[model samples]
Target: MDSLEQTMADAQARLEAAVADRHAAMHSPVVGTPDGDMRVMVLRAVGQGLAGLRFHTDARSPKVATVALHGRASVLAYDPVARVQLRLSGPARIERDGPVADAAWDAAAPFSRRCYLAEHGPGAPLPAPGSALPADLLARRPSLAETEAGRAAFAVLLVEPETLDWLRLDAQGGQRARFVRLGDVWSGGWVAP
Candidate 1:
């Protein structure tokens, strides 16, 4: 592969690793606010799709509504160890029900699925401060069959990228590149960091 191709591949690998690291807080969706600001939230991504990243969220989530209204979104992931920052911008879609959503729900861990089983939507006010689950389910993880109840609230968020800015902050020097799809080929080159 050529230099730009190599750079993009290397960056993609680093981004995938950073995103797969559950301990890292690097994988969050940043949605545009009405005032043109950005709101970032901790979200668990299912994986990367052909065009960009895919993640899971509650159908009742404010983020879901935000994506619906704006259609555009961004995801920023930084790996301190790799000294790499991946900034992905794109149009996002919320899949509430379909083969893809079903597969995602089925693949989720019971603990992760527990969030969907809650009695109230995210950000709902509680009469008293607590775990936010149905009172009866507060003590234990939901059973597999019980997970079915959460499916209705589960959704898949797909981000189709228009651009990916890859920045490497190495001690030797800093290099940045922006990747964009043009026809069947990838196009980008080193730019100012």
Candidate 2:
């Protein structure tokens, strides 16, 4: 292959490796939660672009309304292998019952849709134990028609990352880097560890 092709392949590999490393780090047990707890599933990354890290929640969820009102949120992703942690801050917006919501709904499995159909709201009270599904719904699992009713309840949270602080720990020394977006441009630089 040509030199340019080799260089492009290497760059693509590096970008994929970075994303995979970040994803693995986020699944680590030592990750921190917004409530100051250490939890593995603290954050859910959603959305569709490099600038977007999306999360899905019920429209009635407090966090849903919070981000809707505030338009900002944060996420922490840690990589155990590289001993790196990424702290991301961004502006958030809610997309409900639109193309984005429809797309997200279509991507969900029927079982997940059933949960939404069963719940009234994000933190609504649950049915008594042993409660049974309606006979018709029981004879057959929830169909696409049954799940459609819950589509309005789902909300897509779009977060446009504004800044990312990458911190790494190493034996010789530590490393820190910060990336900030300004208009259409993204600029980054190393900082003191």
Candidate 3:
């Protein structure tokens, strides 16, 4: 056991802890959407470090432009078993085309792709309430052309996490951890939970 080996072991522990923290955060009830609405789930995406988070919405969705204009948003997650909660805030960007979009489009499942092909965006008028897909279309799934159209309509949100608040619950007491990013550097500290 060398000093370098010890250091590497400690770093690995921290990374594992961070992932556990993220998983616990996802299961908590405190997760929130940008609209101040509480019913939405926050999905983290691939990028550099905690560089991206994704939320699916119609191209015409007001939230699409809202996030673009504000460039900042927040997420809250709570866990009962761990008695932990996490809150994250960061700047956001929209990726509409190019490799990023193509990759995400490729990852989407067929059912999800159908939403993209629909003519309406979020909250658009419905065709009566119980209307079925046209008979011919129902018999066959949407073709690649239709799927492509929907993929084009998708707007991928890339959020670059700037700060994170990690809260842990304890029977006797609690704890808090905060991380802030400056340039490429990440500085973190523990506080009262």
lDDT leader: 1
Clashes of 2: 3
Give one digit per residue, the lDDT tens place, for model 3 in 80-164: 5656565667887677777877787887767667767666666667768732334445555776666776776787766667776
Position 92, candidate 1: lDDT = 84
Over 1-193, each residue of candidate 2 has an lDDT whose tens digit, in order, gives 1342342233224333544454544542222223343323323343222365655666776666666667776666656676766676677788887777788788877866665664456455665653233445544568878888877777877667677676768996886767777764656667787
Badly placed stretches (over 4 Å) of model 1 are: 18-21, 24-50
**lDDT (CA) per prediction:** 0.73, 0.59, 0.59
Query: In terms of lDDT, which candidate is stronger, 1 or 3?
Result: 1
Find the candidate with the highest TM-score and give its number.
1
Q: What is the C-alpha RMSD of each candidate to the true structure, in Å?
A: 2.9, 6.5, 5.8
Q: Cα miss at 110, model 2 (Å)?
A: 1.5
TM agreement with the true structure for every prediction: 0.84, 0.69, 0.71
Q: How many clashes (backbone N, Cα, C below 3 Å) per candidate? A: 0, 3, 2
Per-residue error (Å), model 1, residue 130: 3.1
Which stretches of candidate 3 lie above 4 Å from their native place? 1-39, 42-48, 127-145
All candidates in order of lDDT, best leading:
1, 3, 2
Query: Which sequence of candidate numbers ranks them by TM-score, best first?
Result: 1, 3, 2
Across 105-172, the per-residue lDDT of candidate 1 in tens digits comes to 88888888998988888788888877678877777888888888899999988877677788878766
